[model samples]
Target: MNYVLYAVPFFFLLIGLELLADRWRKVSTYRLADAINSLSAGVLSTTVGLLTKVVGLLTYTFAWQHWGVFELSAQNLWVWLFAFVFYDFCYYWNHRLGHERNVLWAAHSVHHQSEEYNLSTALRQTSTGWIFGWVFYLPMALVGVPPLVFLTVAALNLLYQFWVHTRHIPKLGWFEWVFISPSNHRVHHAQNAVYMDRNYGGVFIVWDRLFGTFQEELDEEPVVFGVTTPLASWNPLWANLQFYVVLWRDAVLAESWWDKLRIWFMRTGWRPADVAAKYPQSKADLSQFVKFHVPLRPAQQLYAGLQFVLYVAAGSFLLATGANQSVAVLLGSCAWMAFGLYVLGLWLENRPQALGLEVLRLLLNAPALWLAEQAGLLPISTLGWSLLGLYSLASALALVLVARRGSAALPA
Candidate 1:
């Protein structure tokens, strides 16, 4: 059975609940277009997943060969439970390490790039974590957990996390102790000092409770979400890479080699003394911060909301149909990508002009789909891996153009 096929309906359920909550309780968790854009990114990520799995399989099979052991089955329930919990335990460590180590942090930070916390934020997953992510769960197989069980449980764990992304639910008293509740999960998303590096549970919240890394959501200071070194831009790729790129620049600019070595392994945001001394505190005064203007025009909202429904329906179809090779698959992909870029433009408008470069990026990726076709990259494979290096390079240059336009507009 194609488990991911259900993500379409789940996407709709999330959006509908968000809307219903907004009307009934005035707790509007997402703007329509932003939601669509987020959903589109998720669709694109799954499109990317088809490629990543090939890498995952090769790595897993190679490990098994090196150990001279291979066992596969769908008949074991106890092993599934074991792998399920075991993966969460490993994930807790991987996730916790992601917040602590700068290199790991770089790969994981993209998920926290969104300032407006909502269901959309949940869909904002990292694309690069696959590189080291699988290594963390290898112990499950060594313990003899079936591969099918591992895959299924991981999916279930992910599905369980989806509902926690919303702000609609208030704190559940005792439920907060055993399962990852909205309150505890909200604290995990926060950028505040108290909330930082806490709550690393996946399926069960008990892991956090036992690990001494748990932090409660207090009513005093409301959580200010997103990474401390904020991306503050709309380009999803840039969001994924900004921290690592910054860390790299700092490491290269360091006078001593030890400083370079210390940067990646130390706690994230840790800087060398010399490097910190040269360029000191240039903090923006938050009181002077102007709120981003969504404007929320009635017509604009309607347009965005409508686009959200239409593009999601279209993307969902693409996801379900075409079991790897089919003609005209780009139809759903283009509509979805366009929606992503369009909503990104909406949020980008409120940010610094420097952030709008994402528009060019959105424009740049369209050709990869075409190029994939012309090059006969997959023969009959229409859309499994349409956008690759070409698409990314084009998007980067497109963003550069948007940045250039903005720079030119400023008066000397």
Candidate 2:
């Protein structure tokens, strides 16, 4: 039923509320570029999922049709109840292994790249998780859980996790004992020595407690957010690929064929001895850890924010109608969206060439829009085209003015 689609407005509404709470408490829980980067990663993930989701669905459907032990009916109440619990049980392992292995961590690390713990952080997800994530849920298919029931329960499990990625919520007494609460989840995100690799649960805390991976959030050791190795850029594409690039480089440098192959599946931080000796990687000292930031003028910030709003509007439209689109239209839209985001990342970093790239993007947008309309993928009247042309011209003019004024940098 596309529950995630229906929940989009509420997600932004809650993010707004969290911002209000931060203002009231005089606690800055969100940085403009960081939050935007987080949201960009999420948008990219969703767009990519549209193309890759079929891989998981096909495997699950095949398993269910060919190897079912019982004919599970979604109409049955017990099926719903059991599926909810079972899905989370599977999710617990999926999430745990995501942190414990190198290749899996390469995909999952995008979520931990955010230095701040806010509602926006929850939306930060991976585009590459579909590579192995489907393997964890095969038990559900084998047990005869229908595809509809599995999807519904999986969505519910994800929706339940959204509110837990916050710093304002305090630990609830008995509620912390059973369900996955905000406090425990915060520990799961921490890279502190005591908190690393702990509390790997989705909706229920029972899995972690039973599996001996639970760690209580301690007042003595205040939680420090983010991964041990910082993703020091605001680029969403880079966030998803940084660890993978690192691993690939290490694999290339390794002398032995076995070392080259095994390095990808080894423990999360394991590195080949020869590679490690030649190219040392520095881990952040938590005591003096600093969050990544890039300076931007107020006008640039406003411009980036406005451009992001436009991207979100475009992304929402794509999500709503993308499935019905022709392959050419869908791929074209996805490419345009990705290019806009890549340029946004460049702009946020204050690269001198950002305006040029953005100019190029705007110049291309007109033809892209016209082509979509010509192909019947989009229905735009003359007035609509005129408005878009005007927007492009206006944005170019604004970029020129912002560039001439000499970008004034303010500390983030």
Candidate 3:
């Protein structure tokens, strides 16, 4: 039923409402570059999922068809009730192992990279989780839960998680004891020594409590967000690849074959003794932690924001119609969207070459739009093309004016 797809507008609406709350409360919880980068990772993840989701879906369905122990009917209310709770039990392990193991953490770390914990941070998902995440949910399939029920509960579980990513909600006393709440989930996102690797349940905190992974949010120790190893850039592609690259290099540097082979499957931060001794990695000083930032003028910020809106609109269109698209057209559109996001990341970083790269992006709009129309990905009318042309021209002119303002202006 594409429940997550249908919830997209509401997700953004809540994010907007959160911004208003931030204003009224006189507390800032979002940074423009960080929020955009988080959203970029999310957009990339969903777009990539359109291609990779068959892995998880097919494997689960296969397991259900061949190894069913009980015949569960979707029409039964008990089946829905049981599947909802059971899925969260499975998710607890899927999420817990994702933090406890190396290869899994490499994929799950994208969600934790955002220092500012907000609704946008919830959207910062991994594109590569399909590599091994399907194995965790086979128990539900084996127990004969219908695939339709499994899908619905999974969406509901995820949808239930969205509101818990905010700071506005305080501890809900008794409710905090059983179900996942903002307070406990905030502890889950914290990287402090006390908070690390705790509270992994998706909908029910009961699983964490039963499994001994629960940690209450303490008033004495304020939560410090983000991971120990900070993602020091705004690049979405790099955010997904960061930990994997670290693990690969460590594996290559190890002298022992066993260490090299086992490093990937080992605990989250386990490194070979030889590699650790020879090339020591410095621990982050939590007291000195600073969020990643880059300077931009007001005009430049506005330009970046407007261009991002265009990409969001295009990406939304692709997701809604991707099933009917030819493989070539889908792949082409995905590639273009990724390339555009990478360039936007550079703009956010305020790279010296950002101006030139943006100019190149603006110039490419004409041929890119024409190619998309020819591929039947976009059935744009003359008016649509004209509007897009005007957008590109205005963007190019905006870029020129911003560059002319020089680097001496105050930062955004």
Q: Once superposed on the true structure, which residue ranges of model 2 sit more than 4 Å away at CA? A: 407-412
Model 3: per-residue Cα lDDT over 69-139, one tens digit each: 99999999999999999999999999999999999999999999999999999988998998999999999
TM-score of each: 0.76, 0.97, 0.97
- The reply for model 1, stretches above 4 Å from the true place, is 32-37, 65-73, 281-412
Superposition-based RMSD of candidate 2 using all C-alpha atoms, in angstroms:
2.1
User: Please, what is the whole-model Cα lDDT of each candidate in the order they appear?
Assistant: 0.66, 0.91, 0.90
Q: Given candidate 2, what's the lDDT at residue 53?
A: 81
Model 1 / residue 353 / CA error / Å: 11
Cα deviation of 412, candidate 3, in Å: 22
Worst-scoring 10-residue span by lDDT in model 2: 403-412
Cα error, candidate 1, residue 375 (Å)? 8.2
* Candidate 2 lDDT score relative to the true structure: 0.91
Candidate 3 collision pairs:
none
Give lDDT tens digits, candidate 1, residues 27-89: 656655445445645655665554465566566555554552446455766656667788899
Poorest lDDT segment (10 consecutive residues) of candidate 1:
284-293
lDDT of 3 at 254: 98
